[model samples]
Target: MQKEEFIAIASKVSEGLATDQQKQLFLYHLGTFAKENPEWEKLDLGFRQQIEDEIKSDIRIQVFGEAKWKPKTTRLWPRIVAIAAAVAFIILGVYFFNYRNDKHLDIDNLVMQGVGPGKNGATLTLADGKKILLSDAVKGQLANEAGVSISKTEDGQVVYKVVGVRANEAGKNNTMTTARGEQWVLELPDGTRVWLNSASSLTYPAFFAKTGSRKVELTGEAYFAVAKDKLHQFIVKTKGQDVEVLGTHFNINAYPEEESVKTTLFEGRVKVSPFYTQGEALSEGEKATVLKPGEQSVLANNTIKVLPANTEQALAWKNGYFMFENENIKSIMREVSRWYDVDVIYQGNVEQKTIEGTVSKFKNVSTVLEMLESTKVVKFKINGKQIVVMPGKDNN
Candidate 1:
């Protein structure tokens, strides 16, 4: 296709004025244009920006479906910067094969009015077994345990500030847990920041020992930005594995119900190793896998496998998004179940399918369900706090 023709088609699609046939043809020719015309600078400035916006809109439509597609005006950056963003989106693989213009559901009154998304809330259990409902606790200092002063910020973050330096405080541990439909963020005494997802728990000592590693036990999923401490290593222990790093940013999905424990590294480096059972020693020559940035280590059946990772997808929950990249329906439902605090029931034979897209976690459950329904690979019925999953109408 000629440059002018491609730009015209992109403009039409962006304006929702393109015919189905036009859209299909434009999508087919997209790769050709990108490869042949590597110098996007050759185009007029306005046209370059138009194609960039069109690419982004295409990604959003693939993520949220056309029903939620809205034209957004953005200032163009340097040619290099803007072109890189567009190419990154293309490389990520935006699939528009399931675009349906008539998939918006008329949500039932009950669903439309209720079943909202998760919020910042958690339960804080002290070493003495005192449980403080963080959501109910007023902002500010909630408790003083060991040498740390635990407080809830106005923005709903739980923070621990060291108030005393005493050797006796080393063993005092505290646990922060988020139930279904709730997520929470906290600052550890050592300045590590943790974003805990729904149905997750993080346990750490109120005071870090001067000699050993700063260790924490995790359940479910969490994203961590560990403070750089060259003298002390940071370690996260899960069901069957341990993630060790001097300091790094990473995420761990270790829900007991999940088939594998996944540790995704976003920055710096980490070593993932098998968790030794009681009385079991680390076998000689059994080294941990060193995971670099943008890599993930999957621990299943007592072994760790390393692979490339989609960092955005791994940290989507922490970023207030449900970004699925051809994920299994059952796995997607598991996340929905947690964030919406709903039970899922499969009625009859449900077709196995994978889902792709991105949706805001802050929207009502109905919005997410409707977007997923547009894929024509699945359908849902709301029954009180339960969701009944059935095969999509197209599959009938």
Candidate 2:
């Protein structure tokens, strides 16, 4: 197309005033011209100059219309001209996609916008076989269990420390359990650390014996940061699968309700497999899903899929947040009930809707439920510790 014709069509497109036929012709010609002149094909000088002058005139008109008075002095004109030049440069930069790359997206802002605190209430089982209500406990040391000192930190973290244990017997078994709406942090004798999620328990030794590998069994989800012990590996067992690691940070989701146990490796290497099968080793940024025997990992159709671990999303609970991305109502409620020590009852077909957002667990349960209700997809009514979710009439 001629330069004048191309400029006219481009300007129309830029102003969102192009007709349907004009748009189609403009797109076709633009594609053909781009393909033919792959180099830095310059616009016709006359055409470019005309557009530039038009842009300047448009700016001047806008400023004159908005200003209290017309430009009178040459000095003010220079300032206005400079401002227009800056704006024009910015417009050109955006038009050319100069700053559209991932690097310029401000990832920190994105993360902050999406992160929310996790639910913080849980039931605790004392060593004496007594169940203690922990959701409202003071943020400090709560008790001593089986010679292990248990304390609630100021930040609401349940911490465990072994007392009066000989260094030689450090690998002897000790246990810590938390019920729904609770979480705990345990520091292993070997300097490894574990953050247990609600309804999760961990069994480990008070001290490291240095004779065998450091091993622990988990019943629910947990985030682990293993201290490097090249001589001795660290092992975690959950249900039928086992994870072996030398030293690394990773998250394991082995909820009984979940169809598959997922082991997401954030750093270093981990070997994951069922107790009976010969499993393979996975490196950093990989996830191993332990499917039932005879079942294979099918990316296309498998309901139980292993996904690349977004550390912030996977470990948000441990970091005090509830994060969801396009999660179904059923899954979201399951998490809510576990952390709030409540029971979820679906009065109708509530799982048909999907939600995507983040909310603070520190907020009142009703507030969180109300926010979900604002989506107009579902309605929830709270009765004591049970929540009934029903499909809203207007949801569809």
Candidate 3:
């Protein structure tokens, strides 16, 4: 594009007079300009800084619905900085919305109304069947079980403290459960911290056994940072396998609806063994896989497969976002279903399409649906708490 055309489009955008197509064109040209110029320093320094300011302003306006772009003229930025900013703007645009042929795309169609995202909440079930709603329970001692004090912290965490608990009194069990659209953090008697994802549960003793392993049973998903204990190992038992660790950080996803059980280790060593009875050895032909940092093990059909892991993607729920890397549409919607507490219905035979991006899970369900729709590969329509998924216009 010529300099005059670029200047005109930028002016229209800054003045809030540019159409959607014009805005898309401006960004397309800016990305192309950055790619075409290898030695960006050769450009006029003042113009480069101007381009940087305009790109930042335009992106902020688009994302936040601001009125117009207000260019900053205080100081000049390096030429390389402007080029990098242009590239970043293009990437953000592609991730959030498809600018190409999106002039008539209706992003607001899916979100007739807003369905809020998940938050920190769960229920604590004592061994005797007493249920304490953590969200309503005041931030103090919720119960005293087996001589151990159970308290809800100011930050909404359930902590177990041994006051005068003898070893024999420590075996009483407690369970923490998070319903749909809820999540929670828990501190065990052994100082192991567990972050429970939505629609998940963890069952553990009020206090660890002073002699044997520190054992816990998990369902759904959770991230654990096990406290180091040389004499006593920590064990997490799931449906498909048991993970044994001395001290490590790991995430387990064993939701019954999923095709396989996945265990991702982020730190230290973890041994993933086939599930066995409490006192039973491994079955005749069962085997185990030892995972290193940055490795993941998948268990399905009584078989275990180990491979390199994407730690960030595996722990994205705990980190407050959904990170997808070539993840299929159905798989993505399943996550949306859990965090948003919504049911998904397919309108047609949706193609097996994949998406690659990151979106904040804390946003309203519509915002996430909008991002997916922006890819022009899938579409969604919200009715009450139900989300109807269909192929996008481009796919159609």
3-63 per-residue lDDT for model 1 (tens digits): 6676666546544566656655556566567656433332223335555565566543532
Q: Provide the lDDT at 140 for model 1.
A: 91
Question: Which stretches of candidate 3 lie above 4 Å from their native place?
Answer: 1-108, 112-114, 168-170, 276-286, 394-396
TM-score, per-candidate, Cα-based:
0.72, 0.57, 0.72
Of the pair 1 and 3, which is ahead by lDDT? 3
RMSD of each: 11.3, 19.3, 12.7
Q: Residue 395 error for model 1, in Å? A: 4.4
Candidate 1: the clashing residue pairs are none
Q: Which candidate ranks first by lDDT, i.e. highest?
A: 3
lDDT of 3 at 18: 64
Among all windows of ten consecutive residues in candidate 1, which has the lowest summed lDDT? 88-97
How many collisions per candidate? 0, 14, 0
Per-residue C-alpha lDDT of model 2 across residues 1-396, encoded as one tens digit per residue:
774575466556544465655644544454344334322122222223443453356433533444343343533333333222222221121111111121221111111122222444555555355655556788777776556666776655556666755454443465677777767665665668787788888877655654677888888889898999998888898866677888887888778786567677667777664543247454322344543322222222122344455544575465444667777778888888777777889876776767765554544566567556656567766666677888754344
